[model samples]
Target: MSTEAVTVPPVRTPTSRGSDFAELSRRIKAAGLLERQPRYYLLRATALGGVTAATVAAFVMLGNSWWQLVVAVVLAALSGQLALIAHDLAHRQIFRTRRPSQACGLVVGNLLLGMSYGWWMDKHTRHHANPNHEELDPDVAPDIIVWSQRQARSSRGIARRLAPLQGYLFLPLLTFEGLNLHASAVRAVARPGLKQRRIEAVLLVGHAAVYISALLLVLSPAKALAFAVVHKALWGGYLGAIFAPNHKGMPTLTGNDRPDFLRRQVLTSRNVTGGRVVDVALGGLNHQIEHHLFPSMATPALRQARPIVKDYCREVGVDYAEASLVSSYAQALRHLHHVGAPLRDAA
Candidate 1:
């Protein structure tokens, strides 16, 4: 067997057929789960928000100084979950129009993750548009590690070294406003066409005012710090893990080329868990494959939509890739090992 003869495996990992996709997509579309029931979204948002707020409140109330650390960690996890909700609402067209989504996403995104809704939506939209295409994907900024195999094999490679820094250290620590935050910030300042700077100013200033007021008016810095720390650790780590797993390992290519949207998203991204839990907690992240297929669909709707799409894919015999969080992480590490400029004709 020649080295050239060792064929790379097809991207799909889960064995799905056309029937699965048909039922999932058709069922999802038929369900008319557009823009999720507002009550559902509101209830979910409130519940998650309460859980997060309560956790921090306890830390401050209990007077356990170190509980601040615990609070921060818990907040981080909760923040990640909350952010997912905002993410769903941002994309879910169930809202009367983009305005409502903007309103909701802005308020929710800031409170949950301290990121600008519009900024995130713009970058994310591009990420979806380009997938692994190196040229067009605006989300593939300098701070992010590009994926490629040749880069992995190179000794003491710059790209490989950066992966650990970005994936593990900076990513988990910084949350949304990590080093990449500056690039977007700079972009917003330079272009200012997308309302990025103004939006960011609001978030930052708003955060400062609230935090300062808390410290001055009510909770002490110690208490506030406790909440902030825990929230950052858990939510930051969770968000980094979810986002990094999908694209890190799959494949990298040039702008001239493109992957079939369904095919590439399926290959590059993997669904973590499934069912309503995902639809709710993960904000359709569980329906990651579906969301990639039709990002315009609201995330909450992905739940009903997943089965529809799954059935459709099954009937079509498209191999689907589904991984447990643990498996996904293992693959993410491997994916990080490869990142480079895609050569032309290297599909």
Candidate 2:
């Protein structure tokens, strides 16, 4: 799933930074990069809906055949795309107001994808506020896998045993991410304090009921189970790969290490270098530096904002990190392996 929100702090920068971000912001505003692209989102959503319908038709047509596995892969890709749309919705990139954004997000995330918009919004807000901060960013929090040497040292039980091999196992571990996201949504809705808990709960339950029922009705029990596993696994892997390059190997922040707005985002975020195909696959997340700097900017506009941000960063002497898709993954894996080095030494 995509990580995004518009809850970043106000434009506070250090004096040495010299209103650098303000200048960049002015250029972006003059360029009209912040405006919403209603037509783009409309056509995109329409195309996604049509593809989903066709996939469902194919599922019925194929009917209990082992070839349904192919259909399962298509559904996984579609789910990833739907999640990306929901990500834009959460950021108000499609709709400016909270009501419209939340309405669309719930329909796409909870109803269609069986993921929780409310839960994801909360987690993503903190992440945008602090992209790679060890303590603040939930995306980097130490859990099943650790992101830092300190975390690797503190890891216990399964996490400890897994830490040393985590770099090698990262992709394999991501196969379960789809299940983790669904389970997290369920737990979030079940607990107290989440906004619109009842509505989210109802939508989530409805999605699960319809999804499971459709699978069972269309195929045999064995085939249904296999289809579900493949769909979830591939969906998780696809989404995880999309997000991995954004900040995994980038420098992380910690206690009291606050940089200016531009430096904070530009320093910690890495941009993936690719053409239109990569942009489509990653949902414009390849330009993560731009996305983090302007959380509410529409996905399509990120490409336009990139050069402006990059040039301003150079003038201000902030490092702008960019890498090819393969190189980015390699850098992230290397960082993971390096972090686990202490654990290996201790062993």
Candidate 3:
């Protein structure tokens, strides 16, 4: 048959179903989980805080030697884990009111992790508002790395060269992510216009003083430097590994394609399915779809909320993507590779 005369299949537009957000909200409310369970979260916060403090104390008390590197690495992991607690606090998941939650966020974010709660909230709120929207979502905004096909293909010079190999370089690049976050947080606080900027900056400065003083006082200069490097890099890599799988492989939206809240969050988020071990490690982020839907829910509650959200999605014809840890990573890698293919071909 001639090409012009042949019939071609028409593209099927996704049916515009009415918003399920209100329904999901009702289900979640009926589940009676939106209320902050102070006991559970407070206990979790205390345990994480105590463990992180003890680890730091151990690091300071220990001698400056090869073993200090191991301590530094451990401390970094703890700090990364502590960040998860800070994340929940920032979302007001543990507290009924904003002030107490903000207080907890300051303690965990500034004192414990040496990061800025204000800066994180400024960025993270936008992410929740627009999870995968290219312009609106800070998570997918242009960074040191290119994450989309358009970005990769349009990149120039050195970035263009690196775009093609991003998937392979993803982990190695993540090793530097800890330092990147620190710099970004510092920069954010350094700028004017943020609420209570001076106080936040002071907290950050205090953290820097204490952190550096303890390390330098307890260890030789070379050892201290080594410790800092190892700790920060490991913390970055650990966090990257856990978080990248949540939405990196999922759909990316443009500003105009505004889906309703429930559909937007569920379609863009991917869940990592394992057991409680993975759950704990990811700080309940493994159930990303559920967590995005019910961000204020306590971490433990996310797992409980998963079935409800999944069942709702199935009934509503919404996509709920989930996979094992390894599988999710593979999917993300494939996505990266696909996005960067044009750059690879050009090179």
Candidate 4:
């Protein structure tokens, strides 16, 4: 089959037009998949804290040695992990109440990662409400990269020029995603409407102050710069890789093309198939369909929920897209290339 044909998975139209989502929700609730996993989260948070402390200790002990670059890599990975935890916190996966979830989200996102929790929460909430939507989903909105042909056709200047090769450029561009995220957070807080803007700004400033100070204090200026570059680049790439596969290659819904809830989530999202290590690395995000369906489901329970979701999707005749880690990226890239075809021909 042609790569274009394989880019999007075949979605079976629902055989019965019954209340599919309600039935699936009933099954999932009966399975107790929506229950909070406080104990699991407690253990996860404690472990992450201990590792982060050890990484910091290693950085301090390593002193002015160039070997601290290794520490930078570790720190970058830890930052990604922290961001994943913040994602869960934003979804209220670990906490039952908004107050506790927001509190933890601020600490993990703004205070540690220099990202605005409020900004991310608002954006992610919209994404869950309408995944892969050409107009409504902020994720697919025309940005540095265009996801739809309509956006591609309207692109100007650098974005227009880059559209044709965007498939290949996507991963490379993510190297700067960390910096972009920090910049976005600052811009978000600067705006008037974001909730707790002042608090977010303060915490973001604190993160920057402490992060840069520690780097300069521990290493020479040149080494510190290199360390920062490597750390941020890898952190962005890691986080981007985790999220890119979820919906990029899937069918995008345009105006008035809305599917029912179950079909919408299952058909648009792609699941990554892997073992325990991938689960930990991606922080249960590999089960993208399950995660979207049950946003507040705990990380540990996502794996268990996956089969149930897949089975139900099959019974309802909706496609449940699944791919290996590598293939998922390929599928996404193909879609990018396909979307940019018009731009390429015009060039």
Candidate 5:
């Protein structure tokens, strides 16, 4: 954990940003934490896959009983776990080569989680390249909800009415996020433009066919529908809850604001403080600042790199935001509520 003293960069000034990036990168690289451990990755993938399979089996065993609700909860939890694995595979975090990673992503994402790997990679890459950017970051793009004053002001009709209450609605809306992701992926793969669209579309179809068939085989149609809704909604909300705190409350870059790479990432990403269970559940996204700094870094390594990165930023007078999970969500909600005030004014 020893390192040379690094020079501090001035806040909001980009002149010395290159030095900051170089210094931080140097420290992180020096630790040799960047090296991939195949065993770790394989172990995680195997365990999560087992959980997914076991949960699916349990659901089938439950049949049309009142106890299927318990199986649905377990399935939802496993779905979230698989989604995290899919995200890691998407980032090429586990496998050194692209092919294996892509294969794994297809198995976990498209087949198990019912998400399109190609579609997610496209959107996720843009998000990583320009996180929290008002225009470029797909994560923050104006839609049914608004995250900033400009977006709130431009709202119309139903969106306009909902804009003011968006903070309150955020968690509730996440219940539909799983369905939205499925629909969006379907549309993206249907379009002629994406790479390997046909393959991804087939995988998605396979997911739907297998999933629906399994549920309907044992349960009545109405019960199956209920189980599906619960599983998907809970999965979506779990994903959203983990990801939202990473950047929702952070300073967002607009067209005019162009900070250098290190500064922009550090300023925009927030970390959460917790132990291994939280790390596993969040897919090591609890170390979001470190992950954003080094997108390809393995999740296990992110925790080791955290103190080094945090110390460097502290020495350089850069802000490194980290809070408890509860605190971080509250901050995000507060930011959303504050941003929505403009919508109220517009009304």
Candidate 6:
């Protein structure tokens, strides 16, 4: 296989970061190892099955006043994970068959994120292709991308620091100042595509109607609100950590700084969760190194790639960061602190 040299930016370290990233990308592409459709489908079925059962369980267990909050949190987490499953399925990164994945994505990912499969597929494909590029990537919303170039004309330092942390756990801050929400909005507005925009609009309206009707007409407002808030909080927290770890703390792009696209994903990502919890909790996404090596590869294979990728990272002198769940969460926070340091710009 011919190896491509990746050009690094000024802010980047003069190391093998880009090369390692490139190597993984090349391996994945050459191997033709994409997602394991059957395994992915099975995982989805199990997670969704659990979620559906849990929802019924939540209703049945709602009888426990003391455990209501606990049950709610669990239920919400299940749904969020289910949504992510749908996301994987939709991308058919899990299942190459578009029709099956699309059907599930339309149902689960949309319902879970309060979004639509049609709209998400379009923008998300663009994001994976060009992450953190101010021009091409509309994913800059949320707390990650603050201050337009207008806001950062001079003091890039203060501008970055001044960005909002939004919220920590057990707080509703994330729900109100949603990064994904802002991302989809800005992206929809900027892109001049009416069809995708309309799809997004329908999703939002459809979700809102469901939320309202469920909360008002079915469950007590207290119950509905409780469910919604807890569920969103769970999903939001996961998204926050994943996004921050992905590229926010690594590098920003001018959209033309790099030619090795797949390599950048490798350098910018880390794999965590080396245990069964990796499977039960993160769906093996913690094996980001493996995923980078094979974008289309299923999550189960991520564990298999962990050792190979780690050794490769070490051989090349690039950091192969892997931590337990506890450490990864802390590292994620530290990452936010590092990247979130204020940048002062008078724009």
Q: Report, for every candidate in turn, its global Cα lDDT versus the true structure.
A: 0.57, 0.89, 0.81, 0.88, 0.84, 0.55
lDDT of 6 by residue, 1-347 (tens): 10111245323243553554556556655555553658656766876787678776665656524355576667656655765576577556766677777766756644545655566667677777765555566565433334233223333353344443421321333444334553564455446664445555566567667756745554666776776666666667655544444443344456465645444556555666657765656666777656655656776666766766677656655555566666666654454333333332221
**Alpha-carbon TM-score of each model against the true structure:** 0.74, 0.95, 0.92, 0.95, 0.94, 0.72
In angstroms, the error of model 3 at 20 is 1.1
TM-score result, candidate 4: 0.95
Question: Rank order by lDDT, top first?
Answer: 2, 4, 5, 3, 1, 6
lDDT by residue for model 5 (1-347), tens: 00111122445443454567887898898899788878888798788768767876787777797688778888878888788888888888888899999988887788877888888998999999988888889998878877777777776777678888988999999888899889988998889998878888889999999989988888898888888888888988998988998998787777756677887788888999999988988989999999999998998999999999999888877889899999999988887887789767766
The top-ranked prediction according to lDDT is 2
Instruction: Give the residue spans of candidate 1 off by over 4 A.
Output: 1-28, 31-35, 141-144, 150-160, 163-191, 196-200, 212-229, 274-281, 298-300, 338-347
**Per-residue lDDT for 1-347 in model 2, tens only?**
11211123344444652587788888999999999899999999999989999999999999988899999999999999999998998899999899999998999999998999999999999999988888999998989988888788888988899889889999999999999999999899889999999999999999999999999998899999999999999999999999998999788777776777787888789999999999999999999999998989999999999998888877767778899999999989888888788899988
Per-residue lDDT of candidate 1, residues 127-234 (tens digit)? 887675555666444333544444333424554455444334444443644324434544554465666467656775575577556544544676665555455555
Residue 154 C-alpha lDDT in model 3: 67
Candidate 4 lDDT over residue span 1-347, tens digit each: 23211233444443464477877888899999899888998899999999999999999999999898899899999999999999999998888899989998999999999999999999999999988887889998888898877789998888888899999999999899999999999899988999998899999999999999999898999999999999999999999999999999888877876766776787788999999999999999999999998899999889999889888878766778899999999999998988899988987
The lDDT, on a scale of 0 to 1, for candidate 2 is 0.89
Off by over 4 Å in 5: 1-18
Model 4 misplaced stretches (Cα beyond 4 Å):
1-18
Cα displacement (Å) at residue 225, model 6: 3.0
lDDT of 4 at 15: 42
